[model samples]
Target: MNWYRFSDLAIDDDEISMLRRVHIYVCSSKDLEPESAGGTEIGKMLFHLYRQGVRSELGLIRMVTEGEPPPAAEAE
Candidate 1:
C-alpha cells in the first residue's frame, strides 16, 4: 500500500494562499475580543484547535516537499 503525501497534490498558488489566509484567520480569532465572557472562551478554544490543525498540515506539506522520505518498509 502506498501512503499519500500533501506534496503529491498539485496545489496551485491560490490554494496555498487560501491555506495561509485560513491559518492567519484562526490565529487572529484566538486573540480577538479577549475581554468578552461566556462563549468567547469556547470560541478561542475552537480557534486554537483550528490553528494547531493548520500548522500540522503545513508541517506535513513542508516535510514532504523539502525533506527526504524514509525508506519504505518491504511488504511481508
Candidate 2:
C-alpha cells in the first residue's frame, strides 16, 4: 500500500479537506474512550498520526490491523 505523508497532502487542497473531515469525525465520535485498553490504543494511534500527519485511510488501517503501542511520553 502507498502511504501518504503530510508533505504530500499539504499541496493538495482536496486531500486537506478530506483529512479535516476525518479528524472531525474522530474527535466527535463517542465510542472511542481513553480509559479502555482498546480506546487507549486508538488514542495512541491518533496521537502519532497527528504528529506525523499520516493519511486518514492509512491511519485507520493501522489502528485496526496493528494496534502497536506508541511511545509512552508521546502518548501521554
Clashing residue pairs found in predicted model 2: none
Runs in model 2 lying further than 4 Å from the true structure: 1-9, 31-53, 56-58, 61-76
1-76 per-residue lDDT for model 1 (tens digits): 9765776544567755655554444334344343456335544543454444533545433422345454458899
Counted clashes in each candidate structure: 0, 0
Off by over 4 Å in 1: 3-8, 32-76
- TM-score, each model? 0.33, 0.34
Best by TM-score: 2
| Model 2, span 29-71: residue lDDT tens | 5344445675566556665675565656656545544654432
Minimum summed lDDT over a 10-residue window in model 1 is located at 59-68
Measured with C-alpha atoms, the lDDT of residue 21 in candidate 2 is 52
Deviation in angstroms for 32 in model 2? Answer: 10
